[model samples]
Target: MNTPFPAIASSSEVRLPTGHHWLYGDLVLPESFSGLVLFAHGSGSGRHSARNRQVAQRLQQRGIATLLFDLLTVEEEHVDLQTREHRFDIPLLTRRMQDATLWAQSQPQLQHARIGYFGASTGSAAALIAAARLGSRISAVVSRGGRPDLAGPVALAAVTAPTLLIVGGADDVVLDLNEQALRVMQCEKELAVVPGATHLFEEPGTLEQVSALAGDWFAAHLSMEHAA
Candidate 1:
């Protein structure tokens, strides 16, 4: 399932305008792309998130472009690191992600591409909220070790995009959280557990499994959106 996407190109330090300021990100585009997925890295993570980057690379191989960006500005991140604030602010993150999504949609390379969301950790909450509010603008969603529960029942119930929640088998608490979130969601959804893997999916082959599942899900839904 992992095949090359033709004419791959990337911008490592893209600056996205958020009205208030600019946030940094990396945008990877492949020729004749099927769709674009925006990564919402977990709290404390940014554009350089290794796990997210791996997933993005795998998606690109399957003809999906990806945008990995900082959810917070540099100053905000510095304060968050010291005060442990802003990371769990789901609304704040949601707004920034929305801006990033709109920004990505407006870019020349991504203009005609369907959009999807790939969320990790608390970022999943923001992604769900953004997806719910944006309606058909987001074609699909996938959560890796994410806390979709934090998005709250109202937001979960409103999401229309097909969502897949992936959790590590060994991460009992988060697995349970995803299960509960799944029940509240009204849209097409699924929960996938990676056997013997932990929260970070550091175990060998676990991340690959995650990547494969994500690529397949996006390829199906995003492709359908493009077709429609």
Candidate 2:
């Protein structure tokens, strides 16, 4: 099925470098667009997850495009879930994110636009690592209930893009981790904790808060002009 927003003209699956496969999301031009957002899901979720889908939908409404892809190949997902070997391989996931960023950079549909990363859970670490590697190419970043600490000091310190870290008040451990990571970030950053929300934000109205915070962060930082 296609995205409901008019701005998203079309969407499709893209194969990357033989082993990697991605859902190459495309949004229709709205006379102009702010930029593209690449989504990185947490453990035990995929591109089609309802939670991430909601966030992506909200971003589309605000003139931001999104790419939500499976970080693992079909076989890899099976092995990772079964044996739990490579899913937590932060470096590997970061590399995949970088490849996707490069792929988006080359596409005519997104060529001139800036790029942002929206990461959740373990994917947050991957996103941070990728943002660090991409440097000035990534315009902004947002983490929802993220494990930013997993990215390690080098990746966190290297990220130059403006970053927003959102955590649920009920998620005490993660909240603390985000706080610790924040101290290490050298770039512009903010930490917002949603009251009454849990780790997965399964409570009513909790996910909405995350969506709102993420939307605002990306909107403020993503440039309308691709060349900007």
Candidate 3:
């Protein structure tokens, strides 16, 4: 796991109720926040994902709040670890993302903030679907080495929020998939290819580049000065 970033203005543990389950998460806020970015990690990963947290930290540094939550319950995660059943359930994950956003909107501390999504791997599909369903509620979206094609063409066409799809140049299959999704998407979008990076972006400086790109994208779209 990557070492966590420096302390922020406020950081706390939150529990979001999704009718049948309570998903746990980490919420980090800066002193004077501009917007909130929700994180959706891939299958077999959750709020504790090092890469996601690193990106979240960068957002916080830019005065953007962040929420990194688990998409599955402990029991479901254990079952998925054994059976790989719920990992690919895009609809289920999409509902979870929607529920989490509603939960954030209901909170006194976060209700007034604009919302965005930062998704990695399969979680990108869930984020895109949720963004499409939420319409103008979502201000921006950023995907890192994600399978956005799993979101399907309809959702891609329906997304109105500006999006940035970041892929590792060495990840040929996913890069092509991102290109296809970009073509289907009618919203403002861009595909960023980080040279020499792989699927996980474990290479030195690659993850940092992802963080920088995501921070800039969210800063541009999630600003309070802009309409959501």
Candidate 4:
């Protein structure tokens, strides 16, 4: 499903202001990108996640843009590293996601682009909550080894964007959780289990599959053929 396209046009380090703090991120824009996907990494991860960067690169080849950002400030991340508190604070994470989306929408190059979210781990819950609140502003969502159940019943029921939940088949507990979340979600959605993969999807070719699936989902939902 990964096809060749023109080279990426830009890759930049960006700082997004949310509340009183600034979050840093890496933004990649392909030539004539069709959509923009904002990434919300799982707990303790940031823009430097190699797995996320791999997925983002695949999307770029499909003419989609990507933003991989830190959900917490340096000070907050430091404290959370010790207390393990902020990573599980879903409300705070959701606010950051929303703020990032708004910030993207205000940008000159991305203002008219369709938007999506690529979330991992606990960040998936934040992405869902933000999508539920933002409604059609979020055109699609993809979760890789995530905790969507943490979004709660109300938020799951309210999500309007089409969602794809990718879980490792070998991760029994998380697969069960994804199934539970799928049952409560009323929108267009699916659960894709990657065989032989664990929670981190570190198995051979597994992450590549995640990239292909996510790229296809975003391409379908965030088409450049129509106005967003």
Most lDDT-accurate candidate: 4
Best by TM-score: 4
Where in model 4 is the C-alpha error above 4 Å?
1-3, 226-228
Q: Is 3 or 4 the stronger prediction by lDDT?
A: 4
The list of candidate 3 runs beyond 4 A from truth reads: 1-7
Question: On residues 101-190, what C-alpha lDDT tens digit does candidate 1 reach at each position?
Answer: 989888887887889999999999999999999998999999999999999999999999999999999999999999999999999999
TM-score of every model versus the real structure: 0.95, 0.91, 0.96, 0.97
lDDT of 3 by residue, 199-222 (tens): 999999999999999999998998
Q: Per-residue lDDT for 44 in model 2?
A: 75
TM-score of 2: 0.91
lDDT of 4 by residue, 118-174 (tens): 999999999999999999899999999999999999999999999999999999999
Over 4 Å off in model 1, which ranges?
1-5, 224-226
1 versus 4: better lDDT goes to: 4
Poorest 10 consecutive residues of model 3 by lDDT? Answer: 2-11
Tell how far residue 144 is off in model 2, in angstroms.
0.5
lDDT of each: 0.92, 0.85, 0.94, 0.95
**What TM-score does structure 1 among the candidates reach?**
0.95
lDDT of 2 by residue, 113-132 (tens): 88999999999999999999
Worst 10 residues of 4 by lDDT: 219-228
